[model samples]
Target: MLDINNILIFFSIYMNKTCKKLISCYNIFFTEQGVRHEFR
Candidate 1:
């Protein structure tokens, strides 16, 4: 039972890390697009 809980915790942490990276990438993309749109 303890081993199962440890595995779950590891998976959750890995997911959270990936989500943060994706959000950062999206933010950079949108910021660039917004600037171009405003100029046009």
Candidate 2:
């Protein structure tokens, strides 16, 4: 079985990567919305 500390470290790294991805996606989405709003 995996050690508890190892599992926690792995989970934190995974979450950090996913959080970066989510932030990037949100930035792109908001930029698109802003452009659309300016055109209207």
Candidate 3:
């Protein structure tokens, strides 16, 4: 059986990568225009 700790670690890593990708996307959007408030 899979270990619960390992599963949690994997999920956290995935979330971290997703967050980084989102930040990069936000930077790109910012350079295109400063109207990021619409995204919020």
Candidate 4:
């Protein structure tokens, strides 16, 4: 049986890691777009 507390902890950790990665990716994508706009 899975413990509810353990599941919550694991989910939180997973979400934190994914959130950081997503934020970095979003930043990179926006930066690229901004640079392209400036060049045009």
Candidate 5:
């Protein structure tokens, strides 16, 4: 049904946004660790 398709599209878009956020956060975590090591 058209309604089901719409839901899938919305879900995919939200998931894409969330995925990007998670990846950016993960990178930041590693960067923070590297910076901490340098300071130590």
Candidate 6:
């Protein structure tokens, strides 16, 4: 059970990083268009 918890935590962190990267790329694309949008 402890190992499973650790795996879940790792997956969550990995997903968070991937999501942040995607959002950053999206923000760059939107900024190029001169429109302001936020994610939070």
lDDT of 3 by residue, 1-40 (tens): 4699899999999999999999999999887676666565
Q: For model 4, which pairs clash?
A: none
Query: Which candidate leads in TM-score?
Result: 1
Model 5 Cα lDDT, one tens digit per residue, 1-40: 9999999999999999999999999999999999999999
Which residue pairs collide, candidate 5? Answer: none
TM-score of each: 0.85, 0.81, 0.72, 0.79, 0.81, 0.80
Candidate 5 TM-score to native:
0.81
Best by lDDT: 5
What C-alpha lDDT does candidate 3 achieve relative to the native structure?
A: 0.88
Model 1 gets an lDDT of 0.98
Alpha-carbon runs more than 4 Å astray in model 4: none
Q: Return the number of clashes found in candidate 1.
A: 0
- The lDDT per prediction is 0.98, 0.98, 0.88, 0.97, 1.00, 0.89
- The digit string of per-residue lDDT tens for model 2 on 1-40 reads 5799899999999999999999999999999999999999
lDDT, candidate 6, 1-40, per-residue tens: 9999999999999999999999999999978666544432
What lDDT is obtained when candidate 6 is compared to the true structure?
0.89
> After TM-score superposition, what is the CA distance of residue 31 in candidate 4 from its true location, in Å?
0.4
Error of 1 at 31 (Å): 0.8
Sort the candidates on lDDT, descending order. 5, 1, 2, 4, 6, 3
- The regions of model 1 sitting more than 4 angstroms off are none
Error of 2 at 32 (Å): 0.4
Candidate order (TM-score): 1, 5, 2, 6, 4, 3
